[model samples]
Target: MAELPIEIALDDERATQRLGQDLALALRPGDCLALRGDLGAGKSTLARALIRCIAADPGLEVPSPTFTLVQSYDLRIPIAHFDLYRIADPDELVELGLDEALGDGAVLIEWPEHAGDALPSGRILIEIDEGPEDSRKVRLNGPDQAMQRIRRSLAIRAFLGAAGHDDADRQFLQGDASTRTYEAVTTAGGERLILMDAPKRLIGPVLRDGKRYAQIAHVAEDIRPFVAIGSFLRDNGFRAPEILARDLDTGFLLLEDLGRGGILDDQGLPVTARWEAAIDCLVALHRTDVPRHITIQDGTAHTIPPFDREAMLIEVDLYLSWYLPHKLGAEPSPRLREKFHAGWNGLIDRLENASKSLVLRDFHSPNILWQADRAGIERIGLIDFQDAMIGPAAYDVASLVQDARVAVEPVLRDRLVARYEHARRRDPDFDPVPFREALAIMECQRATKILGIFVRLKKRDGKPGYLRHLPRIEAYLRRTLAHPVLHPLHDCYTEAGITPSES
Candidate 1:
């Protein structure tokens, strides 16, 4: 069924521009937004504001395209502004490159009626009309999906406004493998903050006793886990972002901006000192006694879940469920799947005697920020830890040393592992034998799961960028399989025709 049209009242020119800014944040490439209104209905004003906001330049000159008919900006998500009032023929849309404009980026078309049926179907149509006093009424008609995004953008604007940041400018930061989106917000006073727009989303098919894949995997269904974990980290002297303002029910959070310095150098290679600091942060974190139950700001308790055997098995199943199917173009036979499961079960069984700690599931380069001016582990800023679990400390150690996003060379990888082991050995009871064995097993498990995840990210999530890391993760898997404990998994890989290259 089609969605009903939405009507918004803009009290003045400022509100009209605010709506434009909101739309700017919501736009994606290939989007066409048609503006229908009489002259002086604030169409041009809204377009100009939107273009300027997307460019992140308040003073950007967005001249009226009334005479030229079309104006293009080479900003992020390239924009084409068109005023079709002067067009003599519908075929002129081709000459004006409307198709090409939309192929590369989004387009804002004014006097769209002049183009007749030349406008693309499914384009977001906005009708601006005169209203009481100096106000304008805007009616938006579009696909239900697009309208949902528009509603979200408007809600974010309202969220900012309620936080006394009505005048703030929002710039797109990044979106990860999940449904969450982030924005870099600059307040009127020039204070910078990060906005986490994480609306609750249920993921995947109902698998196993009426639970979804995310539920079985212990993935966060809402922003509450993030709030609880971040608060716990902050209280424990970790540099997790300070929540400046929050609307937990709405899944909007305004957080203190952690600086952009990362462990990777300008050349995209790991820096030794910075990487050491990150390791130190992990060591310090593991040494602390983290409680299973954390109280959020709302006085609600969040109990951290353990990365139990079931979760591990479900995660390992990703290899059989996604990666192997993609590689072979068919699901493996039941016997092979059982062998694969048995291999992983045997490996995880060894971790039963491993040291348990707060495992930051993603502790690699992308999530670790470097704060040079600070001393000790305080120099390390933790950004992504919402999916943290109570698991083997070795799991996090392996995650870092094998850093999936970038190549952590064999020498550096070994040195880092040794560094972590050395730091933990301060306690006389700490045993290196079990820890090393657990690290190898965890590395293999993480690498195997990621092979499926990266493939799934490409095939299922429309993100092909992750595919580039497959070879590296496979190489890490091979390296770990050299350990005697993972020999059975190696044989399983060989049988499945995914024999990791001997390193």
Candidate 2:
């Protein structure tokens, strides 16, 4: 690939540091940066800034590696900082573990000239020089791919600047199981916000009626749904993040920083009070008459799709397509497949006629934040609802009581169900028997679908961590399918040789 060179002028130390931080966003494991500059140049300063940004630690102490020759950091990705000034010969590089460092993680090397022919190809080269008025000038040269990443990083910097947060310190935040990424931005004035980098969803292969799986599954393809849903939630006095600024075209949103107070405690167990608050939030949501269609500022109406039979069937079929083959290493026979479909179809028939509400499909622990200062349901901050659908209210209740990632103790789950039932029973139209049945059916369906999804994540996406939750989901499925209404599903599982006891 051809190399592209770009020049940047830094008027002060902050500008140089900002450039380093921006560059850090584009870096990945195995990438290398060769720093070239004269004595007393800003090479160490820029390297320190880059390391700290990648580590998400602003106050990290990064001493010059002048004496040690090399210093490594355990950032989100491992990084090695090498000051090669002390090296007498290029052959000495191997003795300093440079080759091993380059293989394991990214490296930032100062005085690349001393390395001679030991320098690798495709590495980014940055040269710093003294400029007029005590300023600094930086020239970057790298391969096409690296240059492209740098361009994107620069674009993000410009976007933040245009949003009136020019000097915000960016720190990488945990992303969801989607293409979306996030960064926590802290401004110069100490204001914190979340920067969402959700690019437009790529259209996948046509599934049904020429619609992609994303469309058929009711996944949000852009930021419009999130903005509309968030507005709707806030309008109804819920604790959705307040939008600070947005570039809809770029699919970037600057939102209020909902603090990291999750429903789970440090031991990965549920907090009773927080869980109760979450139940209250769901009760309030289900009681409200949410419109299927909502109008945003542009006057275009965004409609929440129904959890129709086709969508539900496609979701449940993930088990046959991914989980069974991947986990059990056995394909279901035609008879078993037919029975599975027949069972789910029968359950779907019951759900189609049930009372419907806004179903936040993933109303579990990870997506919920606890805000103690707030009162009642408002204290439960909601996130990850862009894929919300109009579905049976019991679906969300099942999701909450039988969380996929964490274990909700059997007793606590029963208590939550009782609390939810009590709240819903207050409505004149609510029927206890049907609600309980629907919750059980939905629980079984969710577990079945997640079994496939977790397997798919391991096989297709190379994420094996999700596999650990399979046993938990299996246990939930067994408990739910024990309901008399799910007898057909239990039979199907037995025929397919996937009994919960084996899992």
Candidate 3:
């Protein structure tokens, strides 16, 4: 299909490099970029800039492939740079393993006319022409889908320019399991910040009451909730990252880069001191009366959603829908599904009447950072709270103690629980028994939901890595099921053959 051509003016070498960086964001493996230009038309410079941006190494040596014909980089996504100026025949392109390189990774080919019509039809074609002074006119043409991605990337570049950080160097950061991605932006003066590229979440198929699961589960669709909640946490003395600038509609944010210091040690094990500090931070947050509605700028108030019954049921249903079918090779009978639902309904009903607090749904090691320079709970930096909801206070405690990703030793879990309870007891209204029961219930619920989620991620999303954590989550389920109050849910698990022993 034909694509609408995009014309960009490169005023100098810097503009050429910036355009290369913008184009890099839209490219993926298996894509080919065909560069058509003369010897001094700045093709090599643009190719070098694109390679360095993809590699996230500004100083990477990207010598022209004029002599070698092709040079490959071991980037996060491998890329091959090809200079076809010396090719004598179209078949010579095949002799140089061009086909294999295009299959394995992205290809950037200069002087593509040397190959005649050997180039792929859908590949991006960029033509450069000499312009006034040191300027160049760059014309981009590609498939409709590729051009759409390039357009969005150009919009993101414009957003950065308006924020006065268009000249900052961007380095890719390790992203989480969600659709959101992050980059570390550093200015020329050594100032650093984080750029969050979170597109508005696409609502899934309508499930119940014409609403999708994200709506039921209180998932944040944009950056508004993060901005509001981060402000609330920072105002309450916690270390949520400050939002410097935001494009709420696009879900793009420039935020303070909370450094890499975290509660986990170098070996990825939990550090006792940091974990203790995180527990103190949670206690401090829960002790206060946090508002459900936060007033954002422009007098817009973002209201925190309640962890209602529909949401809890939809989460736990993952066990029957995904885990049971994938692991057991059979769907649960209607009787079993009804039993599971009834069992959870009772627990969630009780939880609704319990003391409510702001529950950061993922208060685990992955989201908690350590700010050692700060004192007390202030040393704990919080993140990934965009899914925050008004829920039973015990839910976040359960999330911390029985982390889905990290193994919290049983002894340490007990110690942290005791510490949290001790801190809460300072208030006369606090009671230990109900809190313990709530914790046990939440643990069981979270484990059950995660079992289904991990399986769905593997079967539906083709991400099998998450399946490795099933045993740990199953063990957590067993521990919680041992609680006398969770016996009915335990029976449901046994009946469905989802118990740890069965696995």
Candidate 4:
């Protein structure tokens, strides 16, 4: 479907540059933007702003390519700025490496009309016209997909302006396995905040019980869960990022910057002191009698979902669904699949009587920030707990000790677990043996799920980076399966050809 042209009024040069910044956030590799305007129409100014924003350096030198014809930047996403005004023939576009430029990164072409029919039809067309009294009107039209991205970027810019961050600069921070994206916004006052740009969650094909995978897993569908849970954590004395500004319906949030300190050292190895502190943080949290139903300061209510049998079972099924086929080159037989579920069903049943607390489903190194200057449990910054559930506290402990992204050594892992166990022992109701069994069970469950997830990330999402950690997860899974309680499922995994080798 063709997208209608979107028009914006730029009242000043800053607004023109802000459009460039929005374009920076919207465009990706293989994108080409053709700027259409007469001389002195601010095309070069917009291009410069985009290049500098992508470079994450406000002072970057972006000389016009009028004479050079093309100037390339090796920034986060490499970009090529082109001036087609000097082109004597249409064939000159090929010689200038337009295809090569679009191959590795994006392109911005000024005087695109001079290139004749050389431009790709998929390119985004932006036209700028001077208006009365130092104003300009810009119209942008592109492919439906590109238009969607452009619209989202414009919405985010408008949201930021409404939140009083109109002059803030945005730099891409990172993206996770989910659809959400994060940006580091530097306000005009030099304060850095995280701009969480999570649109409404995508609903996959209904898999079971008329629910999608996210719904079954209790994954948050919007920013409301994040706001409610973050507020709850802060009220209970944790360092979750404070919500500075929010547009809940739009899923745009300006959150307090929790700093870049993490539990890992410079070499990506676990820092013992930080790990110990994280254990203490979890200990304190587990000790607290947290209610499942929490009302935020805004009077919004959220009920923490239970990490129930169906959720855990479906999560483990990822191993059979993705990993088994990827490993064995075929689907498991119906008999073997049923056996896999039967084993996990029993394990999940045991959790019904296990110790319950708020489970930060992803309580690992990636989500944990080490705030060196803060005191006690507050030093551990809890940044990613929107999917918090009321479930066995042992699940979170297992997630931390068997850190998914970073390989925590055996000695360190045992020490951290022991520290947590020792601290939890202070609770009169804490039973050490049952907790140890639950930890082993949770370890097997998480590792099994991740084994499939890593492969799925490569096969489904085109992300091969996570596959490198497959061996690490296998090692963790192998260690966990050795526990006597997991023996029933060990054979099921072995038959499926994903049973981690003892070696």
Tens digits of per-residue lDDT, candidate 3, 208-299, equal 88788788888888878888899899888888998888888887888898899888888989898888888898898888788979998756
Q: For model 2, how does the per-residue alpha-carbon lDDT over 1-503 read when each residue is reduced to its tens digit?
A: 56569888889888889988988988877788999999868998899999999988888999999999999997787999998998999998898888888888899999998999898887899999988765899999988888877877777788899989888888788767777888889999999899888888855589779888788888888888898899999999899999988888778889998999999999999998899889999989988888879987667789989988888888898889888787557897798799889998898888866878999899999999999899988999998899999999999999999999899888999999899888888798788899988898888888888998888878877678999998888788777867888888777665544464311
Highest lDDT among the candidates is held by which one? 4
RMSD of each: 2.1, 2.5, 2.4, 1.8
Q: State, as a TM-score between 0 and 1, how close model 2 is to the true structure.
A: 0.92
The number of residue pairs in model 3 that clash at the backbone is 0
Q: What local distance difference test score does each model get?
A: 0.88, 0.87, 0.85, 0.89
Residue 188 of model 2, lDDT score:
92
Model 2 lowest lDDT segment of ten: 494-503
Candidate 4 global lDDT: 0.89
Q: What does candidate 4's lDDT look like per residue over 1-503, in tens digits?
A: 67799999999998888889999999889999999999999999999999988998879999999999999999889999999988899899999999999999999999999988999999999999988866899999989999999999989888889989898888888889888899999889999999999999865779988899888988899888898888778888998998888988888999999999898889999989999999999898888777778776557788889999888987888898898888889998998888888899989888888999999899998899888889998999998988899889899999999989999878898899999888888799899999999999999999989988889889998788998998788889877887888888877777754464444
lDDT of 1: 0.88
Off by over 4 Å in 4: 132-134, 297-299, 495-503
TM-score of each: 0.94, 0.92, 0.93, 0.96
Collision pairs in model 4? none
lDDT of 1 by residue, 394-479 (tens): 88888899999999998898888888888989865568999889888888888888988999999899899999998888778777
The residue pairs in collision within model 1 are none
The candidate that achieves the highest TM-score relative to the unseen native structure: 4
Better of 1 and 2 by TM-score: 1
